[model samples]
Target: MAISKSQQFFESLWYRKTVWWLWVFWPFHLLLKLIVWLRRSFYRIGIFKSTKLKTPVIVIGNISVGGTGKTPLAIYLIELLTSQGYKPGLISRGYGGHSEHYPLSLTQSTSASESGDEPFLIYRRTKTPVVVDPVRARGAKELEAMGCDIIICDDGLQHYALQRDIEIVVVDGNRQLGNGWLMPFGPLREPKSRLKQADHIIVNGQDMVLEPDPIQAINHHQDAIKEPITAVAAIGNPERFFKTLDGLGYQFKRQSFPDHYQFLKQDFESFSGSILMTEKDAVKCLSFADERFYFLPVSAKLSKPFLQSLMEQIKAITHES
Candidate 1:
């Protein structure tokens, strides 16, 4: 799942302190800013209109490029809503998936290759209705048709085309806003100021905690994989996953890959011992995984105060509807 050397170099340049080389991408950064501003203006003045769904839509995403624990938060929200007699549905852009169709309603037989990793993993974990489509408004509509009382968008904070009732922006506690620059220059997809407009800002380590569950086997029994393991992650922040494993006192070789990487059987052909990965990566490897493949699952432990505030907002929205 490792990315190319050039990709590695660019990531390092973006997050780390490298001053002189940043000039190379300065022009592109300005252009991206201009485009972002124009898009927002269009949506603001009615030149472009956002599609508002009948059911309330809550978008959970990050302003930064890499993972800020959006999937875990989305899952937590789904569970929270379901416990209160609300039928919640999830919609995602399906970043790595190339489905033959749009607005795909996930079935139990759906594979990660078709519905994307996060959507498939969420559906498997929650047994809730999940839809994948590039146009999130259409996906939201499909969820509404499926009898969902509310919709949870996995990562579409800047997707202005889909009107959202509440926006929850998640930020990595350690990496706050890398270099505070946009796109090629830094990790931000939007400016840091955009966070001011969000309904709530959830910092990964502060507002919510990611508690790792018992590691489970992907293809066999829980005790199948032996010691001398190798943990791999194809997530936005592989180091974070490795750090968590270390904190849990598990010793293993570390392997990192580009985000949303399509894993193959040949990738693990060299490893002699057990292979461990994040639950997101586990979904993609399930098709070709062996007994040696295992995955670590993490659950979001949100603060009670935030939970109370969130439910209050949802109740207000429902009462209005």
Candidate 2:
């Protein structure tokens, strides 16, 4: 699908330094801020009650519009918790999916169209139970009923309706906070001050000094095709993926699509040679994909100090409850 001109214009303004036309959206930004503040205040004062489940809930989310590795971070947490002997279940809002039912449980047979792409990817990659619902609290309840000991919310930092035990805010190291302005004027979903409230703040891809890693081995699948490949991403920030590929010394054309973009077979018909995409996008393409398509999965390699802090907090929360 073609991107709208208005969307392109605003994205440019959001990432670039302050431009004169940015003021045109200032009123809308202020309105958004008011709504956000009031909504948060209501939750805090009990006007809007937040449901707290018996099991501890850990949220991996961001304050910005685009991706900050929430899915990767969530997967990381799931693996970490499981290694620590916790049965962690995943929950998501299913952003780009529509279903006849609520709290749809995901399994290997579940299609990406039924569950959102990210949730499907998580289920496929981790083999963990995933539940999708617009009402995340309902999803969490389902997970708890399924014998999960802990819950890891994919992207719900601003979702005050479900009370969380640990809040993790993931930020893009390169794009930091994008003009530092809230929605309409910039990319932020919440004020920068909100970072202080999060139990942990993680920066994705902080170590640019790329060393030999497992990701490089995955790219070797393209060797079968002699022609140059194209790296296509239907994610929020495609540049980060491209930069990682560049750091790995791979050469390919870049094709970017809007976040959560639904893929059709025809989208790749014109392009030849191998195609690379993120795991999030790969889930949707598998039905129509072939040997020419390969996806590079990323993991959030968080610092040891951050991991220690997170483990400490989880211990305290679990002990207290």
Which candidate achieves the best TM-score against the true structure? Answer: 1
Q: Could you tell me which 10 consecutive residues in candidate 1 have the lowest summed lDDT? A: 1-10
Q: Cα lDDT of model 1 overall?
A: 0.89
For model 1, residues 25-54, the per-residue Cα lDDT tens digits are 888888888999999999988899889888
- Backbone clashes in model 1, listed as residue pairs: 1-257
CA lDDT of each candidate?
A: 0.89, 0.82
Off by over 4 Å in 2: 1-5, 207-225
Error of 1 at 183 (Å): 1.2
Candidate 1 segments whose C-alpha is farther than 4 A from its true place: 1-5
Question: Each prediction's TM-score against the native?
Answer: 0.96, 0.93
Q: lDDT tens string, model 2, 81-158?
A: 899998999999988877889999997678988988888888887888899999999999999999998899988998
